[model samples]
Target chain A: MTRIGRVWRKSVDGRTAALYLLPSIILFSVFVFYPMFRTIYLSFFLTDQTGNAAIMVGFENFVYLLGSSEFQNSMKATGLFVLYTVPITIILALFFALLANEKLKGIGFFRTMYSSTMGISVAASSVIWLFMFNPSIGMFNRLLGVLNLPQIQWLLDPEWALLSVSISTIWMNIGFSFLILLGGLQNIDEHLYESSRIDGAGYFYRLRRITLPMLSPTLFFIITISLINAFQTFGQIDILTKGGPSQSTNLIVYSIYREAFINYQFGTASAQAVILFLIILIVTILQFKLGERKVHYQ
Target chain B: MKKLLTSSLFWVLILAFAVLTACTNSDSKEKNEPTKNDTSSETEGTKDDGAATGEKVSIEFWHAMSGTGQESIDAIVKGFNESQDKYEVKAEFQGSYEESLTKLRGVGGTKDAPAITQVFEVGTKYMIDSGYIEPMQKFIDEDNYDLSQLEENILNYYRVDGELYSMPFNSSTPVMIYNKDAFKEAGLDPEKAPETFAEVIDAAAKLKTDEMYGFSMLTYGWFFEQLVATQGGLYVNEDNGRSGDATESLFNGPEGLNVFRFLDTMNKAGTFGNFGTNWDDIRSAFATGKVAMYMDSSAGVAGAINNAPFEVGVAYIPHADEVQRNGVVIGGASLWMSKGIAEEEQEAAWEFMKYMTTPEVQAKWHLDTGYFAINPAAYDEQNVKDKWAEFPQFKVTVDQLQDTIPGLATQGALISVFPESRQQIVTALEELYQGKDPQEVLDKAAEGTNRAMEIANKTKQ
Candidate 1:
């Protein structure tokens, strides 16, 4: 009788567990999985003005997108954007996280300041950065003028527009990276550093040997997140550069947006989206494969 | 302990995956949600109050106009609602022009679609080709309404294949507005504005100084479209896509090249300022004395006069010194009647559109906003005449429209993918601004736009 009761209780608990997971699973399916699969399916057909897939032009969109100069440029821009934003954000965030982890008197205030940017939405930050990047009346140019430096056309000159947009993105991302790294820093056992200090390890030596190795898991997490965020960067690029001064800042996401909504060429847009997915997927898999060796999980 | 560790690790993996998917999903989600407001509210509003008031027809009118434009629209709607007790007109501000059109197309064949919609001029071909618009001419023909009462030049733009698809509402034209005080200071006549590109260059050279640029315009395709029209050039093939469907763009021709060269030369000469494509920035630059001359929609005249501390002068858009100056295409939007609504509601919408375009109503709109009156008769109205004397800048647009020839070129490109073409032109213009060869950039842009047109054409088919 006791054995039957145990089995019954286990069955009831399993039912409850399934019920608890239902909402998230449903949401993940509807909002995430459904749209993604739809994007891939719609890649095989041309969509009309109302975004309903109408024409069955199988593989034509993919062929067109792969051969197109515009899509090729967008891929290159997306790559450059990722390269520009990711490492800089990770390093600065690590530096700030280390500083904020200290038990100094004003450390709490500095930590708050470092993570404050997490509160600002991409729209708000992009608008703020846009004003700062304006060529004639912006703060950066005023400072340049004071130093007798020539004023740079931040958003207009094709060479500099992408870099200008990346500056804003890096600023927007630093806070999220800092908060994660800070959590990682605080979780490290205090005795690890104490043992390192007793072993005649200086600050640089300890950072290299202990802090980095101990923080590798968090560092790995941060790197992966930052890379994904960099690939998906859209709002700042949309507002600041508008993918131009000659499509110099036309990242993959922005290209997808322009194609899907602006031009309403959903087939081509979906094809491009599928390519973006493949690119990101391959990149992440490669990161896990190559980067897992260095990430010492404690 | 191992069980707990592994269980927690499994959940963490799920959480990480959820966050990753959610992050990417958020971008398209936020960008797309504004265009999908439930149309259920539209039908209920009619039944709730509309039926209670003795079976009154409640017609929804969706518009993109907001801020000052909304206020004007609200006034007109109120006027129409009060002017008759049989029909109740409900006006809603959907979003930007693009958003409103997207929403309209989304509900294209549905009863929830508004009885009347304000579509921008570029949306003309798309609206007609969608097969969801009840041609305004159908109503005019049914009622035996006199179409000749409308301004021929403004009416010319909305007419295609010998029938009007929509009613011309708020119309403006591209015009050059200069700081008259600055022009005088620079030893150029404030009264005599530059009528040709060469003259503008000459004037701009003198007006530019160490502290200020002489000219600045938003890097927009509308201005390029105007430049194309000023040379009496078609923007698309097949008679500017009026006689037959345009399969390709005509914007890569020598006329487009000349316009590019003119702007590029002005840019290189240090006389023209490049303000990236924000109207507010360009307007503020002119207002703050950073630039002496600017070209914008004629509707910008009111904003200039209100904001600028100096005198603002309005002039006709400049032509190439060599090319004969053909007049400009109309700017701004029009009112289109939806096909799926009730016949009573459709008739009511038609009545409201006609009322809105009358001399008194159009004049009121023209005075409140800087947009040109759709009816030329509005200019002769006593109130409009008085306001014209007070601010003579309003007369320039009227004269420009009056002088315009409603031929194929000046009738404007009526292709479905005009907005896409505009975007492509901006890209080419930016490339030109960055010192790329105009021929290369425009040719490439034209190729892309032609492809967009082909796709649009195929979709329509």
Candidate 2:
């Protein structure tokens, strides 16, 4: 380390290196640590209707959440949502990234086109999708009628609501995932591809052997990020289905929001949030442990 | 020189923060500060004199209203501010009714809360329990204000223990809106709107064709609440919590079952298209002639008139054949004054509230927005008289409200957990439409609502 960077060493200098780290340390403690501990504290209480931590119920909120059939349904729904959106996003983004990485005509335009959805906010995109998913006069139904296909009850029916929301989420997430993959793809050494081709490797053969292996680190990052985001799905579900058609789209975060803001049960909401956190934590840790073996650092 | 550079970098970081600490607590920041807190409950006003040396007290007035409704509110605030020199009421659009409450609750125990707020009817119990509100009765009694000019049925919804809690500002009742062109095409009497669910089903058969539907209403909880009341049934026990605090919900009764059955049968026959709680879509559908007869807030009457390609007809919210149509509960929202503000500010809010309900202001509100004026006297105003003559649809809500027998059921339930209860009912209604047994859904929903009410009641103690 530079002498100036380590100036705070007690035996060496009077200047403190801790000064530079103070802002981030303070911010992290205030924003992250405080809310985490506060949520744990709140879980032991029963919140009043105005969401005040009123009565100390001594883990009753947690107990209730553990037994709540509705909360269980939300967990199942969130799992389905993650399953539906994550792989689809990764695959499509990888495909688009591969396509955009080529030395084709006007490739920058295609790259811009692929990544353009990154500019759209969740609410705005959800509204656009809402128009497409409307039961009666939606674009999808109109297209179905024209093609002589059976019209789907996109948002109204319970069977299709989750899929409908997932379709929009996948579409929304593809841009971000594509950008990350593209960066990873660009960083790959050209000589490796050239050598593989010279070694009698076909396009598919080289892709499976080299491209996929090298893209693992980016894939790992995108997978975990999208997984966390999918678990936190709210805007699309709220805007499109409102967790409705018999709670088909009632993801955990939306449920937590309702418990906190709508039902004014801060304790229950906090309990639910803690449960969701633990779930995400365990899943993410498993991903990291598994991914550490698979991902190539260089 | 290296030491000087290192020390200078440290000083630069400190200077950057000094410049970055430039804060502007603009009115928007003041408006939004309450939203930062975990508590979504509002705290009352902290005084800041707008002008030095006895100038007009600039008190903020927050509302959930937007669109043309917001324009109307802006006009009202402007009128009030101009009419008096003592106070300048700065009206701010907080958000939707639900968001406004969340923001209000989030701003708990802070001085940033607006002096007066617009809260929906379902929030009555919660508002009272919060103790942030200064009851309208306090100011009314202190001034001996004449309350008789307001419609009793409309006023009853806002009253707690025979004392008014909030002033009904812009109120509405659920009314049946129909497409007259479709009705005429179906060979049904276009003017005679159906009064019972059976009659609606009968009308639907005739109205059904290759391109259009006869009925549709979203699985909106408010409609379910109204349907329960239209049958002279209370949603909760203990006289809808007017006579005493309600301990349980009563929506699983035979009346409730029949209402569900009626909706179910309509769904089964493909006569009633369930919109599934998107009122905006259903309203647009009616306007575009996709649906013929649908029940919507009386507030939609104006939108229907303006937007519908064909003629629009209105009637009281349909009832069951065996059930007596007592009345539909008021829907829209009311104005509430918060506690802990200065007396002059409180009085100013009262004056503004009174001004808002005055015959002229009420008439303007009714004409501009589809919401009915709470003041019965507003109907007598010449401008409203002209509006009634021009668009007879405007009187349907007022007449429906007047015909309503003033009972606890029609007055609406006074439950603090009504929002959650409403959400549960919406869930139940959606499940019912999805072909679940209506009785089972209602029972499950009722149990959930009852538990929520019990929790709420216990908390208050």
Candidate 3:
């Protein structure tokens, strides 16, 4: 009787565990897992009706996407954006985090101000940036003119368009990364820094040997988040430049939107999206692998 | 103690599961609800009052007109509401033309659907063929509504296969809008605008200064339509713009080459300014006086006049001298009635539609908005004639349309995928405008458009 009761209790526990886990498993299957698989399924076929998949095209979309100049330029733009934004955002966020974390007067207020950019919508920020970059009446050009420097077409010129977008993106995103870094900064062991100071380690020496190594995990987190955000840059381009003057600012995600919605090439757009997903997946895996060597958990 | 810890761990897991399940259920509901609404709206046609209890039948009318246009539409609706208490007509402004179409298509069921919608010419084919729109011919036949009072050409635009699907409220065609100040500054007569393409180019070159462009036209399929029509060539060989069984395209012919060559020349002559790759940008550039001579929809006149910081002179679009006369395609939205409404609601809709198209209402709409009155009788009315005296250029759009040669090209095709096809043509034009060989650009555009047409035609099949 005792053995039977124990067996019944074990089964009941198992049942409870399964019941508890069911919702999340179903949700993941519905939203993330299902869509990823559906996209892969869709990538193999072309659109027949508006959103329906017809006969299987079998890798034709991928081949065509690889050959298109638009896709090529989009990849290049996305690559440049990620390159420009990831390192700068991480470095600047760390600096801001360190500065705000210091025991100084009005430090909390300063910290709040530093992270305030997280509240501003990307659309509003892009509009403000457009005004600031306006050549004839913009503040940036006016300041340049006053300083007797050549005025740049920050949004107009193709060469500077991507750079301008990157600048706005960095400003918009720095807050999230700074907050992440600040959280990590607050978690650090203060005794380690105290011992370093007692041992006559200078600020730079301590920062280089202790602070950076200790903050590696946080930096890694920042890089991962920033890279993902960089690849998905759409709102700024959509609201501001619209991938112009002459497709100079056409990023991958924006091109995906244009292809799917504007051009109504759902099949090709899906293939582009799949390609974007694969690239991000590979880069994220590689980033994680690389991060393992540098990130210090202890 | 170990047992307590284990039990607490289990409780934590359960709590997380509860939160996750709640989120998952809520999100699924959110995603599925909108799609359901969309499907229902497409079928029901705003039957929120599904239970008819002999109460006054209220009908919804969604439109995109705002400001002066909005005020005029509101006045017409108010007058209709007051004219009879039998039906209550509620009019709502639903964003821009594009956004209105999207919203109308997105919602499906009684809570949000409008009984009548003002669909633009670009969306005419899509709405007409979507099986959701009620044929205006049916409404006319049922109610014995007379469409003969409407202008023939304007009425023809809303007709599909000799049957009307929509009624034109206000129609407009592209006309030359030149700056009188810039014209006088360039030592040319502001009253006499450019009459030929060559003259336009010359005037534009003469007017070219450090701050201004000579000429700028919004690059789209419509531009090609006007350009091809100007040179007496059809864009598609199909009847009524349907390209079914069509073997060849007319755009890559001589007319196309001439149009593109003209653009390439203007591009090289520094007569064309940095026109953005879209209609709004092109229009804004022209309106701001950055471009001396602008060509756009005559319907855009009111907005242009109200917003433009300088005097704008409207004139006939310059054509090739070889062509008989200036021909411009009509551009504006028309009221499309969708299917699935009750007889009473449909009658109410027709009443509102008829009221909108009446000479008096149309004249008020046109005069207030600068869009051409679609009713020929409106022009005969003393109000329109009197208003024309103050702004004589308003008559140019009508005069230009009076002599228009209607066919597949100039009549504007009602293809299901016309917008996609237009994009291809625009893309080719953009390539040409950027200095590609004219013939090469023409050939490329023709090829791309034909390929897209083949795909689009398949959808029709």
Candidate 4:
């Protein structure tokens, strides 16, 4: 009887625990999960002006999206954006993090400066970069002029618009990655470095053998975030370029914005958004799968 | 375990409190009412014994004006609120034209939108087609408001099939803005601005000096629209500027080619500062006096007149040698009344609408914003006349509109997919600016535009 009573109490405790998690689960379902499901569901249907009633159009939106040259160009641009931003942001963040992590004078100031950019919103940073990149009166061209080089259309030339946007993203995004790397660097044991030094290991050899392997987990984290962010790039394009210099600066989200808001193609835009979400999801999963093998918990 | 439980309980209580607060806030806050944050809300329930009133009628007006515009709108709303105690009108600034549209659209339900909203000229078709806007003629006829004083051209942009959907608030057309300092630097008299296409080209060539271009024009589709309109050409075949059909893309003609050729010529002559990506860039370039002359919206005058480092001279946009000067269509926003408001609120809205269109209000708006007075009588007002004379550049837009032809193309076509089509045109222009042949670019653009139009037509009811 006592055992049965204990079992009943345990069952009650389990229910209580579920009750504790119920609100968050409900919120997650309502806000995040439901919207995600709705996004996927709406992607397959043609919605009316009010977005309430929809006509069942199986795969037509996807087909149309696939056939669209604009969509194709946007996909290509997004791919290039990912390629440019990921390596550049990670490398630049690492460089700053390494420099800031050094046991030198004013290291705290350098650390603060490196991480300060994380506080600026992407929209605000884009506006600041727009001023900085103004072709006629920008600081960039003035510096170029001082070097006696010809002025270049940073955001106006289709060939350079993607790269230009990438640079702004780099400057705006590096701080967050830097913080992650700095955390990873701080986790490395000083004893290992001391032992390596006592055993006649040089700085470069120790770094390659110990630091990189130890930091792989953080690198993986940054890579995942950078890739996701690069794919979801919208603010810089919307604020700085507005997909201009002849549609060369357009990314996935900007095209989605144009489709849903400006063009009122809600269904098509939803389809595009779903496609992007899936791509990000697949890439992220792949990253975790690959990164899990390299991430030494110890 | 006790600490964990306490913290968990604390968070749960906090979340519950937040959710409850949000719910109450939303419920008390009237949804879809235009003047949600109106002054009437703050005034509380005060019974004025002027007319029959149980619960006081309050109407919401969402506009994109702050600063002077906000102050003026507030004064007008205050006047309406005080003049009669039966109804209270509230005016709220809802950020930019794009932002207002986005907000209105985001709150999709009928009960969540503002009673009245200010949409830009390009969005007239989109707003009307969305079936949210109530035709102004209904409010005018129902309430017996004076309608005869409204100008025809000003009203024409808001009409679809002879039915008015909105009232013109701040109407402006494109005109040439020149820096007098830059003009003098180029050894040209600032007073003698170029009046013809040939002269503009010649002046531009002569004005090209160290790091300065004689002329720069925004290469957006609006410029092409204005160019085509000025040359006595139509952008759309039927429905003029108000068509629901999307499969009828027609900007690949001689006139469209001419626009490209002209831009190409400018580019080759180093007359453009490579700032044709957007309107702000063009304005900022002209403001800095790096470009001697710029063809942009006259509404942009307020920004330049107040912010430009040098004095600005406004003039009519130069026309082709054969065609005479014709006015460009207005580029500013208009006010639309949304559905789902109470009869009392609608009446209050009409009263506010009439107040906005009155000569005194419109004239004040024009003088302050560099937009044209929608009421022709506003021009006759002594205050408006004084401002016009004080800044001679303000007269250029008014004078240009006096000779407007309102050709099928010049009327500014309103289609469901015009914004997309405009992008297509810009894409083509970009290609042309990159040295591609005008004919080829137009043809390709027309093809792409036709495809977009097909999609729009398929979706249209």
Can you tell me which runs of candidate 3 are displaced by over 4 Å? Answer: A1-14, A33-38, A54-56, A106-112, A132-160, B1-53, B65-75, B103-113, B219-221, B243-249, B278-288, B380-387
Per-residue lDDT over A1-298 for candidate 2, one digit per residue giving the tens place of the 0 to 100 score: 8786565454343234466678976875675566677878888888776666778898788788879889889999999999999999999999999999999999999999999899999889999998888766789988998999987888888999999999999999999999999999998999999998789899999889899898887787678778777887777887898888898899988898777778887788888888887787687667765765786656
- Give me the displacement of residue B273 in model 2, in angstroms: 0.2
- Arranged by TM-score, best first: 2, 1, 4, 3
TM-score per candidate, in order? 0.91, 0.91, 0.84, 0.89
lDDT string, candidate 3, A90-121, tens digits: 88988999899899988999899999999998
lDDT, model 2, position B248:
84
**DockQ (C-alpha) of model 4?**
0.29
Query: lDDT of candidate 1 vs native?
Result: 0.84
Model 3: C-alpha RMSD to truth?
A: 6.3
Off by over 4 Å in 4: A1-21, A52-55, B1-55, B66-68, B106-109, B180-192, B241-246, B309-311
User: Which 10-residue window in model 1 chain A sums to the lowest lDDT?
Assistant: A289-298
Relative to the true structure, candidate 3 reaches a TM of 0.84
Better of 1 and 3 by lDDT: 1
**In model 4, what lDDT does residue A155 have?**
87
**What TM-score does chain A of model 2 get?**
0.94
Each candidate's fnat, listed in order, reads 0.26, 0.41, 0.05, 0.29
Ranking by DockQ: 1, 2, 4, 3
Q: Please give the CA lDDT of all the candidate structures.
A: 0.84, 0.82, 0.74, 0.76
Docking class of 4: acceptable
Kindly report, for each predicted structure in the order presented, the TM-score of its chain A compared with the true chain A.
0.92, 0.94, 0.92, 0.92
Poorly placed runs, candidate 2 (over 4 Å)? A1-20, B1-53, B108-110
